[model samples]
Target: MIDETAEQLRERVAVELERARARTALLTDAVDDDDLIRQHSPLMSPLVWDLAHVGNQEELWLVRDVGGRDPVRHDIDELYDAFKHVRADRPQLPLLGPAEARGYVATVRDKVLDLLGGVPFEGRRLTTDGFAFGMIVQHEQQHDETMLATHQLRVGPAALNAPPPPPAGARVAGEVLVPGGPFTMGTSTEAWALDNERPAHVVDVPAFFIDAACVTNREYARFIAEGGYSQPRWWSEDGWRHRMEADLTAPMHWQRDGDGWAYTRFGRTEPVNPDEPVVHVCCYEAQAYAAWAGKRLPTEAEWEKAARFDPATGRSRRYPWGDESPSAHRANLGQRHLAPAPAGAYPDGASPLGVHQLIGDVWEWTSSDFVGYPGFAAFPYREYSEVFFGPKYKVLRGGSFGTDAAACRGTFRNWDFPIRRQIFSGFRCARDAEPV
Candidate 1:
C-alpha cells in the first residue's frame, strides 16, 4: 500500500490510466474500421483517433513536463491533436490499434506518476502556463467521458450503459435549515476554478428547507400521476415549448407500458423503480417537478452556502468533505462508467452541515444561470467559460458518477443547455425560506 500522500497521487494517476484504457477499449470494441472514418459532427472526432489523441495529450503534458525524453511520435500531429488539426482532415490520418495506443497511454501515465511521486503537494502546479497537476488528472478524466459518449454515438446503446437505477423511495433524512443570511458566494481562488466561477462575491439569501436527497422517480410519479405535465403553471413558457416540441410526456427514454412505467437504459428496458432518483430528467423537467411539489431548486449560492459555510469553518471548501481529495468510499466517481449511483452511497462525502451526496452520484441542478463571476479572466482554455455565459444554459453542481473524483470538487461547475436530457442528470429541491 502507498502512504497517504503517495497514495493520493498514485490513486489520481492510476484512475486516469484506467480511464484511458477503458476509453480505448470503448472506442475499438464494437466499432468497425469503416464506420470510424464517417463524420458524425464536427464536435466529435473519429473513433480511430481517440487513443492517439489521448496519447498526444499525455505526451504533451506528462512526457514533455518530465523532460523532453521523447520526441512525440512524428505523425501524432496530423493523426490527433485537435488544437493542431481540424476535424475535416481526421479521416486521412493513420490510426494505431488498441494495444499500441493504450501502451503509449500507459507509458505516459507511469512517467507522470513517477515524476509526481517525488514532488510535494503544496503549491505544485504542473504546467508552465499555470495549469495545476490536478487539471491534468481532470483533463484525462474528461477525455475518458468524451470517449464514452463518442462510442455511444457511433456504436449505439450497447456502447455505454448507465449504472443500475437507485432503489425507489429511499429516504435519506437530514436537512440543513439555513436562516437565510447574507453570505459571500462565487469563486474565491485562482487555484483551479473555471472563469465563470471567478470574481468571487457575495449574495444574501432567505432561509429555506432543501430536501436532503434529490427527488426520486417515486416522488416524481406523484406529480406525473396528478397530471404534472398537463399543468401550465408548473412549467415555464420555454419549458412548455420544449415539452410540446419534443412531445415529451415523461423523462427522456421513459415510456408507459400497460398501467406501469418502464424506461430504456443501455439498450435494455426495465420497470421504473419509483423510489430511485429520477435519472435523465433535464433542467426543465426538474423545474416542473419542483413547482408541482410546491418547492423550487436551490440557487447555486444557496447550495454552496449549505455545504461550504459552516458556523465553525466559515469558508467554502474544495470539497464538501473539506480540503481533502475524494476516495472511492467518499463518492461514486472515477469508476470508469457513466451512470447515477445510489444517492446515499457516499455518506463520507457529505458536507460539514450534513448535506448528503454533495460531491457525486448526479449533477444537481442549481437555480443559477451560467454566467461570469464578478472579475472573471480567460486562461489558456479561452473558450472554457466565456463562450457559454449566455442565458440558454444553467449551472449544475456536484459531479456525476461519470466524472473523475478530481473533477468532483465542490467548486466545479457544469453547465448544459436547459432542454438537453442525454446526460446522467437529476435534481434536488429547495423550498421558499422555511423549514419542512
Candidate 2:
C-alpha cells in the first residue's frame, strides 16, 4: 500500500509526464510532415528523430527499466540510442515516418502511464521519489528545447508564435560584488537533479564582481565595431583559428546592413535590438568579447555563488530570488516569449547580490570545463554525464527562455562544444574584486 505522500508524488509525476507529451505535440504539430523530416542543420537531428527519440527514452526508462517489461520495439533501440547514432547520420537511417513515429510515441506513453499507476516508488533508487519519471520528463523537455532550436534554424515564415515579453524597467547599471567564501556548489537533495548535479559539494570562491545583467547586443556590438574578430590578441589560439576559418564577424543569424545590424529570429529578420541580451553566441565569442572589454567570464563556481548564496544565512536557495518556484514575474522561461526580454527585465528575479536574469533569458557560458563533482557517481546510466566530462566541452549555467522548470534548477549543468553557436547561449563578464 502506498502512503499519502507517495500517492501524491505518483500523481504529480503522471501529470508531468502528460504535460511533457502535450508540449512535444505542440512542437511537432506546428510543422507538417515534410518539416518533421527535414534536417535544419548538420548539428541537429531531424525533428521527427527527436520526436521518436523522446518516446524511445520514455519507454526505455519507464517500461523496461522500472516496470521490468519486455521491450515494445527492441529492434529499433539502436536507431534511437543517442550514442549509437550521430545527428548528421540519423537522416540516412531507416527512420520511422512522421505518422508512424507519432503512433509509436503515443502507444509507449499510454503503456508508461498505465505502469505508473501501480509502480511502487520505493523499490529502487530510480523509482524512489519517482526519480525515473522525473528524469523522463526532463529528457523530453530537453528535446523540446532542441526542437525549438531547429525551428529557429529553419528558413520560412514563423511557424511558432508568442507575445512579446514585458518592457524593461529602470535598472541600476554596475557589478555586484560577491565576497570570498565557501558555499555549497551542487545539490544532493534535489529529487530530480541529473547525475551531473549530484553529490553536492562545497566550493571556496574568491571575491569577484560579476555583471548585474547579461551583456546586451549594444555592448557586444562594440566588440564587433572595434574589429574584435580581426584582433587576434583577444581570442585563444584555437578560437582564433576557428574564427578565421568560419569568417565570423557577428553573432549567428546576424548581418551588417549599412552601418546597422540585422538579425534573423524565428524566421523573421529585423533590426537588432541593442537593449536586448545577445543570444546564439558561443563560448569562444563570449570569451573574446569579455577579454576585449577588459573582463572575464565567471567561473561556474562564481556564477553559482552569485546566484544561490545567501550572505546573511549562508545557504543556497533553489533559485536566485528564493526557494519559491519560477513564475512569469520571477523569470522569462518556458518559451513564453520567442526572444529574451530587454536587459534589466525581471527585477524580482534578482539574486541576493542583485544579479538579474541569472535564472533565465539565455544560458550563460562559464569559464569552467565540464567535469564531475567530488564523489560523483552515475545513476541508472553512465552515458548521460560520465561520457561528457572533459575539456572538449564548456559548461553553461542558468536556464534559457526555452528551458522548462524540470531542467532549470540552480544546480543543473549544461555543456557543449565551444564552437556551438546554434544554441540559445549568451554570457556576462566578471572581474576580480579589489580587496579592502
lDDT for residue 306 in candidate 2, whole number 0-100: 94
TM-score of each: 0.77, 0.98
Q: Could you give me the TM-score of model 2 versus the true structure?
A: 0.98
Model 2: per-residue lDDT, tens digit, 1-436? Answer: 1234877988888888887888899899999999999998999999999999999998888989898888888888999999998999999999999999999999998889888889887868998889899899999999999999999999888999999887887574679999998999899888888899988899999999999999999999988999998999999998899998988889999988789899999989899999889999989899999999889999999999999999999999889999888899989888889998887779898988899989888999999999999999998799999999999999999989899877897898999999999999999999999888
Q: Which portions of model 2 miss their true places by more than 4 Å?
A: 1-4
Assess the local accuracy of residue 124 in candidate 2 as a C-alpha lDDT between 0 and 100. 88
Our tally of clashes for model 1 stands at 8
| Local accuracy by lDDT, each model | 0.68, 0.91
Which pairs of residues collide in candidate 1? Answer: 168-275, 168-276, 169-275, 180-206, 180-207, 199-375, 207-433, 218-274
For each predicted model, how many residue pairs clash, with residues at least 3 apart or on different chains?
8, 0
- The numbered model that scores best in TM-score is 2
How do the residues 324-399 of candidate 1 rate in per-residue lDDT, one tens digit apiece?
7888667767544445555565677677667777777777888889887767776545665787787878988887
